[model samples]
Structures are given as C-alpha cells and as structure tokens.
Target: MPVTGADVRRIALALPGVVERASYGTPGWRVSDKLFARLHEQDGVLVRLGAIDEPELREVLTDAWRARAPKRLVAELAEPDG
Candidate 1:
C-alpha cells in the first residue's frame, strides 16, 4: 500500500507546531519554522524529510514508502498531542 498525497498532507498537518507552505516548487512542511519535510511533484506520494541529512532521510523515506502512510503509525507520531 503506497501512501497518497492526501495521506502525506494529513501527516504533515497533524504534527504539533507544524506549518504547511510552498517552497522550492513543492509543498513543504516545517517544524519550528524550519523545513522538516516536503512533497515534490516528481513523486506522487509521501514526503521528503528535510531535517535529517539527505542520505539518512532518503533511506528512511524509502523504507516508509514501502509501508505507506496512515498505516505507518505516522499519524500516531504526528498527532499534535502525541
């Protein structure tokens, strides 16, 4: 099950203090006003976490890509109260 754009959006928005905005021609999600995630047009689903270094983020995201969203406990972790 692959994550959809909507799922990614939900995850990004649910995080506490997370802010959604457009940057670098993509939908960007930020933590404390610094970019922590983004979803690009090249990829149809999921987000690219920008807080971590490129290689680590890419590797983690690749793994998540297989697990999909909502089902990945992403929503659990993203909840404002969580």
Candidate 2:
C-alpha cells in the first residue's frame, strides 16, 4: 500500500534529519530548509509525490509520479533554487 500523507509527514520529520512543513497545501519535506519532497492528498492507499527533482524520479517511478502535481509543474520545480 502507498504511504499516507500524515505518515509521510511524521516519518520524514521524525527521521534522523528531516523537517516537515506546509507547502502547496501538503506536507513538505526538507533537509536544512532545502525542499527535497512533498506529499499529496490520499484516500485509502493512493498518493502522489512531488519535488524539485521530480522529473528525475519520474523516470524511476513512472506513473507513480502522477500522485504528485501535474507533469508541467516539474519544469517549474526544475528552476534553480534561489
């Protein structure tokens, strides 16, 4: 089963070094304020993952990335951090 947003938030935050916050209406995961990932709304066991490097992960996870923001947002996320 896919991980739930709340679980993701709790686990990511409780991990050795991960922080969680609100971003785009979902839980944001960061390491030292750098956004590495985020979660989407889920019902039952389906959920999405989004991030600045989403495209790179998309190739690995294939359709699973859809649980995140639309494909176009990937480019926006690709922008260099400022």
Candidate 3:
C-alpha cells in the first residue's frame, strides 16, 4: 500500500519524545519541539526519503528523532538489546 499521513504519524510517534502538532498549517511530528516530519499541503508526507517504503520511513524518522532528541535519549537508542 502507498504510504500516507497516518503512516508518517504512526512511525514518527513511535520514536522517543515525539509529539504531534501543527506545522506549516499541516500535521507535524516533533522531538524536543523541533519539527522532524510534516504533511505537505500538496505532497502528502515529506521526508525527502525518495521511495515510500516502511524501512526508509522508519530510518528517516529515527534520524530526525536522533538529531533533535536529547543526547541521553539518543544514547539509549544506541545501546544494544540485552
């Protein structure tokens, strides 16, 4: 299925400290109050990830989250599972 705003919302919100809010008059996801993803008025979801695959979506969201998340939070993500 083609990716949609809901997909973006779901994936973005899964990351730590992610929040949903309005950005550029559309739905947006943020970490530390910094916008990481938003629904474009005409382009649907915008992350510049080219194809709309789930893995790419997750990667973009995670990278954006890491960039805006606190150091401690990012560090926790880097920790290997026990």
Question: Which residue pairs come into collision in candidate 3?
Answer: none
Candidate 3 lands at a TM-score of 0.79
Q: Positional deviation of 37 in candidate 1, in angstroms?
A: 0.7
Per residue, candidate 2 scores C-alpha lDDT tens digits across 1-82 of 3434455555454433345677788767765455656765565423343332434433433322223434454444455650
Candidate 1, TM-score vs. the true structure?
Answer: 0.51
After superposition, which runs of candidate 1 have C-alpha atoms over 4 Å from their true positions? 43-81
Error of 3 at 15 (Å): 0.3
Q: Best candidate, TM-score-wise? A: 3
Overall local distance difference test of candidate 1: 0.55
Error of 3 at 56 (Å): 1.0
Model 3 residue 29 lDDT score: 88
In the range 1-82, model 3's lDDT, one tens digit per residue, is: 4666778888888777788999878888888888877777566535543457788778878887887888977877777840
- Minimum summed lDDT over a 10-residue window in model 3 is located at 41-50
State each candidate's clash count.
0, 1, 0
How many clashing pairs in candidate 2? Answer: 1
TM-scores of the candidates are 0.51, 0.41, 0.79
lDDT of 1 by residue, 18-72 (tens): 6678879888766545666667757443433333444454455434432443343
